[model samples]
Target: MATLPYWRLSGFYLFYFALLGATAPFLALYFHHLGFSSARIGELVAIPMLMRCVAPNLWGWLADYTGQRLLIVRVGALCTLFSFALIFVSKSYAWLALVMALHAFFWHAVLPQFEVITFAHLREQPERYSQIRLWGSVGFILTVVILGRVFEGLSLDVYPVTLVVVMAAIVLCSLWVPNAQPSSGNRKVLADGFFKQLRSPGVLAFYACVALMQMSHGPYYTFLTLHLESLGYSRGMIGLLWALGVVAEVLMFMAMRRILLRFSVRRVLLFSFLTAGVRWLLLGSFAEHFWLLLLAQLMHAATFGSFHAAAMTFVQRSFGPGQQGQGQALYATLAGVGGAAGALYAGYAWNTLGPTITFSMASVAALAAAVIIATRLQEDRP
Candidate 1:
């Protein structure tokens, strides 16, 4: 019973992302267990994100205006816990969608603003942001691999219970996390959307690029585990493979400060997108080749790690403290819209086009992201 002292910012991220690790990779499989079709699963899974389009901003606005950041996180987590409690009743799509929408509406609210919280704390030493964030990867990998093994002989009904526990942890962490509030802190409503800040050509281009790269991940998130299962990989292996991707992400985060010092955020994103295009292409073309598949997992550092870290940096630098909450909200909204579309489309395309063709589209989308960066994104000297 020793109290955990919050340091720099990494401890919170470890718990925060560990929650994500417990869920995102496994939710699809959980839906798969509900006797739902892939398409139905996509819809169910995407509902929370789909709701994120508006929910996070609404919550972010409240946080920015009220200066009640911790309360917002607590409320979001409580709603998440309460919303999921009804999930056992979700034997059908309508019921599931309703529950999902409710939970997601709240769940999405916490992160966008909390990301701002993390960044706010890291204002002086931004490089250490990843050192803390890497714990989230650790949490994610731990959950995926352990849960994968646990699920090999078990059924999928356990997803909700596991999710609730993870979410509760997030809430607990938020309650204990102390962020310094600036004396000048006050939020003013802009009549227009953050789209104004995005009026800059480079900013717009960067946003579009992120949207594309996230969109390309649709197929991989929706069908990768099932596809691997069809290829005869066990649940345990799938979890570890998923864990491997996080491991790479964690490694990338540890080295992120050094990397950022040397390269521009735009350059990192461009490289990540290009690597994603190639990674999905290879996975689709040679999924049955295990070693090749592992190599593709290694590329996850580019697709997710570098790409995400760069995107966060861009967001952090793009807007000042006044717009921090909304800034994070905008990224969540865009990712939600793009990621939901990708996951949904990939689900439908999955059985018909097959992983080969489906993942080819992923490559195409990621490549398009790279092209957008080349044409639209121009960064000043860092």
Candidate 2:
């Protein structure tokens, strides 16, 4: 196979995340169409994401040990394609849950390893990292908008097939992706242990802050569609709004190199965490204004994009080749644990307190996250 272009790296990012954009916005609605109850949908959606806690770390270790991260990515993409395509085979809650778990099990293997691949290439230069990964945001937005428009005509019945098609494309791209050349780190160094790594003040603090941010997002992802649907927005509009957020995310990724140059990653993380609080509060308080909603979507740049990029940069700087796998695993673990808890609580909150109160809860979570970062997270320069 020919060497992959730099843009092709971006292409892979775009396609994978575009698959996310295609599904995340509409899956709840699809479950609704299939007669699943609201709480059930929330639980179902959370299951796949929640599985990230265990799956990624296991796969990350496999890649590091075998030096076969690209092969894992290919396997994950193919499994995702197959498992997602089987979504139509059964509609029972148990069966759907099983399918989602299997898909997520395979799906979760791609990201952390891919992060390793990107960093392995750009270890000496992180600026290019965002440029490649930013294509993911582009893919996400483009897919969301097109599908949003498509769903305007078709009923939600097409959700399964559409997701399958996109996921299969991701697999095909994975097949063509160029593999990473392994690094020659100290092969004998093994005593560093996960706890010792966590003892690093910077890593611990960063993980804490990230966990909080992920926690804050729980309600929005769990019930945002249901919340809006209850408020009378059509499915297409919801998808468009989702696309709008990704557009903001794309812009931020494009600008991330400049931002990092000017600002410390810790500082950026702090600001993003703070902004998330404000964003969630505004979303809770101002649900009716279309313009306000659009503006809030734009805040996704800081809330998720900047925050995520900062975290990734921090990982790359803090960990060595020997520790890279474990570093990424820890990040995924904290995110998964934090995200799952946040999403579960949000589901409960939405079930109990309704949208305004549930979203207010999310805002509170964001604020708590900001405080954790600001208080525990320290930066020498910023």
- Write model 2 residue lDDT over 225-300, tens digit each, in one string: 7777777888688888898898898889889999998898878988898888888877777867888888889999
Candidate 1's C-alpha lDDT?
Answer: 0.79
* Model 2 TM: 0.95
- Residue-level lDDT of model 1, residues 276-362, one tens digit each, is 999998888897999999999999888988888888888877766667777788788888887888888888888778889989998
RMSD, one per candidate, in order: 2.8, 2.1
Alpha carbon lDDT of residue 250, candidate 1?
A: 88
Best by TM-score: 2
